[model samples]
Target chain A: MDPVLLLDVILLLLAVTTAITAMAIRDLLGSVMLMGIYGLLMAVIWADLFAMDVSFTEASVGAGAATILLLSALTRTGTRERTGGDHHLPALVVVLITGSVLIHGTSQMPAFGDPQAPAHIHVAPHYLSQDIGKVSQKSSDGATRRDFGDHVPNTVTAVLTAYRGYDTMFETVVIFSAGVCLVLLLRPRSPLRREQADE
Target chain B: MNIDGHLIAALLVLIGAILSMIRAAAGPTSYDRVLAVNVFGTKAVMLLAIIGFIGDRSGFLDIAILYGLVNFIATVALLRFVETKRLT
Candidate 1:
C-alpha cells in the first residue's frame, strides 16, 4: 500500500478500536475520554482525506465541543454505567450485517483520488477555472457577483459561501436555534425569584 | 529537506496518538485519562501541521491552530467538571 493510504488505514482502524472501547467501558467518564481520543483520530483521518475545511469543523465540533458537552453531561448524571441486564448479541449481529453491506456498497465507488471520478470532473473544472475579467453587474436582471478579482484559491470557502449560500445560511440558523434551545433547557432556574413568586 | 521530514513527523505523531489512546483506555482514574487525552490532543495538532506541510498547503495549519485552541479549552473544561459537579 502507498504510505499515505497505509497511514489512513491505520488511523481508521485505531479510531474504530477506540470507538468500540468507548462503548464497552463501564465507567462513563472513561468512555467519554476514549470518545475524545476517537474524535481527535477522526480529525486526522479527515485531514488525510484532503478535506481540510471539514477536518477543521470536526476538530472544533467533535474533539472540542463534543468533549466539553459529554463531560458536562457526565457531571449531571452519575459517573458509572449501571452493570448487567442488557443483552448485546442482537445489537452486535445487526452491526455486523450493516458493516458488511456498507463494505459491499463502497466497492462500487471510485477509488480514492481518481481524477476521472464524477465528483472531480462534473463541476470542479468550472469552479477552478479563472474567469477574472468576465463581468456585468446585472446581465441577468438580478443582483449577482461577476468574476471578482480572482478564482477563489481555496474552493472550500467559495463553495460554502457562494455556491451553497442559502444552504450554509440555513445550517447556521439551525445551529443558532439549537444553541438557544440548549440554553433554555440547561440554564439554572433563579431560586430566589421562584421563592418570592411562591409567597 | 524533502517531504520525508514531514511524513516522518506525521508517522511519529500517529504512533504517539495510538499510545495515548491505550493509556486512556486503561487509565485507573479520570485524572490519568485526562492527562492521556491532553497528550492525544497535542499529537493531533502536530499531525495536522505535519500533514499540511506534506500537502504543501499552508491553509491546513489554520485548522491545526483551531484544534490547538479547542484542545486547551476542552482540557480546562474537563478539569473543571472533575473539580465541581457543575461546569459553571
Candidate 2:
C-alpha cells in the first residue's frame, strides 16, 4: 500500500482507540490530561489531512481551553469515583443495531477519493477550479470562481459568516443564554445573601 | 513513520476517553464529573479536527479555532461564577 493510505489507516485506528480509552480510565484528572494529549494528536492527524485550520482550532480549544475548564470544575467539586456498573442490555442492543445499519450503509457510498463521486464533481470542483475574480459571475464557468480576497480562505468562515451568518448569530445568542442560565442556576439565593448581610 | 504509531496514539486517546467517561458516570463529587465532562469535550474537539483532515476539508479548521476560543471563555466564565457566585 502507498505510504499515505497506510498513514491514514494507522491514524484512524489510533483515534478510535484513544476515544475508547478516554472513556474508560478511573482517575478523573489523569483522564482529563490524557484527553488533552489526545486532542493534540488529533490535531496532527488533521494536519496530515490538509485541514490546517481545523487542526489549529482543535489544538487550541480541545487541548487547551476545554481541559482547563474541566480541571477548574474539578477543583470546585473534587475527584473520586467508581468506573461504572453493568451495562444496560437495551442500550447495548440499540448500539449494535445502529452500528450494523451504519456499516451496511457504507456499501452504498462512493469509495474514498473516487473522482466520479458527486462530491468531487459538484460543489468541491466548483471551489477548486474557481478563481477569486469571478465569484459573482453567473455564467456556468464563471460561477465556479469563488474569490477569497473579499472573504476568508477558510471555507467554514465563509459559510458561517456569509452563507449562514444568521444561523451563527442565533447560535451565539444561544451560547450567551446558556451562560446566563448557568449563572442563574448556580447562584446563591437572595435570602442567603441577606442573611450574610445581617451578620 | 509506520501507521502503527498513529493507531497507537488514537488507541491511547480512546482509553483516556473511556476513563473520563467512567469518572463522569461514577464521580462522587460534582467537580469530578465536571472534570470528566471537560475532558470529553476536549476529546471531541480533537476528533472533529481529525475527521475534517481525513475528509480533506481544510475549512473545518476555522470552526475548530472558533470552538476553542468559545470553549475557553465558557470554562473560565463558569469557574469564575462558581467561585464568586456573581457576575463580576
State which candidate has the highest DockQ. 1
Tens-digit lDDT track for model 1 on A100-160?
9999999999999999999999987766664534464665667666565435546665565
True contacts kept of each: 0.81, 0.00
> Candidate 2, residue A69: CA error in Å?
2.3
In angstroms, the error of model 2 at A39 is: 1.3
lDDT of 2: 0.61
Model 2 C-alpha lDDT per residue in residues B1-88, reported as the tens digit of each score: 5544544454566567567756755676646655665676565456545545445576766656655565565455445544654334
Tell me the whole-model lDDT of each prediction, alpha carbons only: 0.82, 0.61
lDDT of 1 by residue, B1-88 (tens): 5776766777888888888888899988889999999999889888878877777778878888888898898889888887886688
RMSD of 1: 6.1
In angstroms, the error of model 1 at A90 is 5.5
**Each candidate's TM vs. the true structure?**
0.76, 0.51
- Model 1 chain A: weakest 10-residue lDDT segment is A130-139
- Tens digits of lDDT, candidate 2, A1-199: 4434555566567567666766776666555655664665576566666767676767776666666656655664545447567779999999999999999999999989798999868776555444433354355765544465454575454444444768878979998997897677556559978799789
